[model samples]
Target: MNNVDLELDLNNLKMIFEDLHFNNEIQPEQIPNLDLYMDQVITLFESNLFETKRSVEDKLLTKTMINNYTKDKLLMAAKKKKYTRDHVILMIIIYNLKQSLAINDIKNVLKPIVEKIENNEKVDIDSLYNKYLLIKTNNSEEIKASAEQKLKEVKDEDGDVLLYILSIIDMANGYRKIAEKLIDKFFENTNEK
Candidate 1:
């Protein structure tokens, strides 16, 4: 592409990064305390997490997915066809983690807490979810800053879009690898006991 075209492309990419506003995390307080039916749970996720979708047709949660999560033991079974607040909490965690982790890995990660919830024991999942949101918010800022810096470098170097993409892919792959490694270290063997 020509210099002007390349500059425009870079500018568009920078704009894309600048436009990433991630304030859609569902707070625990926002979830209804009353038990929700399947459709209601789906509606809650769809309404609260529409921004997280890459396309209008993309669903944040589906009945099939919820069924499969329960089948796979990634989620606990609902009582009397109704899901509780803890169920919503687990669903939110599953939705986020599924982006980067496999189903089995997610089940492994959530196993202990799932057990606690299933056993009618007190669980502090809200605290954990809140803490996760805090970290995610902090990381969103860092990611925006990093993207701006990288985009500037790429533009200054005559718009090396390939290099910029490669760097992003590398960072994502590295994080995924670390997450997998931690799961292996802490959770993989837990099921065997």
Candidate 2:
């Protein structure tokens, strides 16, 4: 076999060992069934059971309906399994922000809010509402006031796109919070240079 193929095989074996070790730690009795589970996982992978990808244009079209600039961001988040429902709700807020604010400005405003939501911590919605007011007024309040309104109004033609966008947003928020905690930890441990 070529070096690349050998490397790939070695990596696969390492992964199998790791899974076995993890299962042994969690439930030793399950060791006997490990081969069966591995077969299932291999079959699922080969069958494209976890395949999920959306075209950039498709994601953009989805965001366009919502009037948000979060298409690319949401796509990346979804790819990483970090998107969720609340993140989608937050994207509605972002759509309003995009009407008047620059992309960077909108991201700055959303970073903290998304972080809080991902961490399962309380967020100051009033403050966020006020921030939204500073960015855009029209449709902003409506979006914030009724989080589920647009979702309900979404028709069958656009339902899947909307739902996918929402899932991506949710994941993005989760990843954002995880990233924030890691950064905070780094800063906490770092001595001023």
Candidate 3:
């Protein structure tokens, strides 16, 4: 793709970014106890993900995907063709995580928590999900602050949009470097076992 700068309004850009409010996530307590069937589960996904993006159809999830997740042991199997609240919670987490990580990697990341839940150990899945929600709520401000800091660090009176883009790229590269280190540490621990 060409890096030609467009005459974008910075205020509009800020507004666009600010407008990305997260509301699609349903709370753990709000999840219905009435176990949902396959079609109902699919409908839940469709109804819950994005209230906007009218032009975009989110049809990526299907029966096969749910089945595969269950078969792969990444999620607890549905009981009697109906998915429990726990099942729906896991499904939502898995689906969202799938956007950035591989299925196997997702399983690896969640293995400890899922195992605890499965073993009927002292694990509150809902509490864990709620904690995740809390963390997620705080992240938008953190991300915005980071982006602004990156912009300031790269600011140049003579620099155009390319400079800001480069700044973001630098930040992304830094994140990648640290993420790589974390992954290395993760595997190092696993390798010891």
lDDT of 2 by residue, 30-69 (tens): 1232232223322322333112213223221142433233
Q: Report the poorest 10 consecutive residues by lDDT, candidate 3.
A: 184-193
TM-score of 1: 0.88
Count: clashes, candidate 1: 0
> What stretches of model 1 exceed 4 Å from their correct place?
1-14, 189-193
lDDT of each: 0.84, 0.40, 0.69
TM-score of each: 0.88, 0.27, 0.77
Residue lDDT tens for model 3, 1-193: 2355554345655675656544457667667888999888877777776553334665646899999987777777778999888888888888767755656666666666667667878766777788888887787567777776655554434455687787777776786667556655573332234
Q: How good is model 3 by TM-score? A: 0.77
Clashes of each: 0, 7, 0
Q: What is the C-alpha local distance difference test score of candidate 1?
A: 0.84
| TM-score preference between candidates 1 and 2, better one | 1
